[model samples]
Target: PTSVSSRVYVTIAAALVAQLHAAVATLKPFVWQWDSNDGAPAWLENAVRPAPAGAHNTPIGLLRRDPRTLSILWEDGHRDDFDVRDLRLACHCALCVEEMSGRKLRDPQTVRADVSPRQIVSVGNYAIGFDWNDGHNSGIHSFNDLRAMGERAAAQSVENV
Candidate 1:
């Protein structure tokens, strides 16, 4: 009887977790696109930007990822660094939540190594979902989120200046 009860609990827990993932997935946007001058990948642009001198500092390239490391390139020729693990921890998907409660969840620092490379899943009107290598299939990051982070970082840079 005890074993049966335990099994029941496990089943319920799994169901609850599934429900959470579904909920988060719903928040994902569609049609996220980037215009790289001449259609270059965003990371490549980022990797090459920082090396150039006396160019437009505005990012000429921007990267988005579901599981892959996204990078950006400044028109003036400087690259910005982005970590894939950090991106995953910020997954806005419901499955990313705690099982017992449908609250949001983040990647624990210890589990960062498990964060997977992302494949661009679907492009939404303004967002994109990445398929992570670690089997995390949720977390669609919007362009707005990306731009906001960049703006915040830029603001911090000004503070440092």
Candidate 2:
């Protein structure tokens, strides 16, 4: 019943609406909540600062040892060794730690000494993910955190000496 030009305009309008919907869906994950109390975006509260110059957090190589151990060689000529049990205890995921309060939900005692990773995969350039033999896989351990652990271990060793 509509003229040809009107039908073409309606089709174009529908396509534009569809494109707008798609764009919103793609950007949904990046949308941040505005906090009225703090007058800042919610994501800004936990924004990670850039690492200082000459401070390397990237791992050059990761090696898994028998009986549940991981060795990470860093770009800064430092190597970090971790037992599977220690890795599990150090998980910083929301499931393991309460995001709001930063309270640990996972008890370290419950993670057995013999617990091993079923699989280890890189989450992205920033973190490594572990699927544990005990059926836990929610944690993504960032390179910065792993490096800090290594630094802490080194400090502890020096203190004990």
Candidate 3:
């Protein structure tokens, strides 16, 4: 009786483990958000990174006063300004970034200096999608990635100043 029960327990444990993995896979997209700290827990470190804690990184307000810039106010009181043209050029859509090699296919010269967003839409809760006047709308830039981009741009600006 013990031998049979142990075998059943092993099968049940395997099924439970598989279910847990599936559940984690569903939440992987949320967990893999870009983080300022640039690391993750040991269990998920290699597979899924992390992002800002909850509402701290959520966009509270989005402002586009002109075609030149898009400003976002985060829930944590951080404001990030993004250049319209640069955002267009930095699109990670399949058309902008190669699907297989991950190389950037967009040539800076191909993007006009005044290229701007034709429409802006939210992608669920985690991303902002842009439709460019230049006729590309496939890229959906996540808020996490955008935050990182803004941070990099600010760093460069500071270096120049």
Candidate 4:
């Protein structure tokens, strides 16, 4: 009887050990090695790469808009001025453009000259989102894209002169 009881105890212990092993194995995917320095997880190190050169240098000082223009003062002392109408017309959101085909759905001519942003918000430190007075708000304009557009406009002005 003692030998039988010992066998039953061993079986229960083996089953518990197996269950613990299974639970650990199941949670292996969810377990992450945390880093102490930056407080980010080890798995996220490869997943989250550093932003591009100028990408991190977003508007530091001020982002302001008048009735006619939207202005961004970058961290690197670069000022970008965008015409309100031009900026509204350049919105590349799915509602404004076809996502797959990249065709413009919203008529550029339909946007009024007096068009302005009703609200502006930052998206994850990488992009700026705008809610236009015309009730269009799906667009998320990246800082990189905005800087490029500003540079392009500056080049065009120089060329015209």
lDDT of each candidate versus the true structure: 0.54, 0.66, 0.66, 0.63
Q: Once model 1 is optimally superposed onto the true structure by TM-score, how far is the C-alpha of residue 153 displaced, in angstroms?
A: 3.4
Q: On residues 1-161, what C-alpha lDDT tens digit does candidate 4 reach at each position?
A: 36998999999999998875433110011111111112211111111223346443455433344457666666445677888778889899888899999999988779987787666655665676777778888898877788889999999999999
Candidate 4: clashing pairs of residues: none
Clashes of each: 22, 0, 0, 0
For all the candidates, what are their Cα RMSDs to the real structure?
21.6, 15.7, 12.1, 15.8
Q: What is the TM-score of candidate 4?
A: 0.63
TM-score, cand. 2 vs. native? 0.65
List runs of model 2 lying over 4 Å from the truth.
Answer: 1-55
lDDT tens readout by residue for model 2, 1-161:
29999999999999998875433110011111111112211222121233236446856556554455677766545668887688899998888999999999988888877787666666656777777778888998888899999899899999999
Q: Give the C-alpha miss distance for residue 4 in model 3, angstroms.
A: 59
Structural similarity to truth (TM-score) of each candidate: 0.46, 0.65, 0.65, 0.63
- Candidate 3: the clashing residue pairs are none
Error of 2 at 106 (Å): 1.5
Candidate 3 lDDT at 113 equals 87
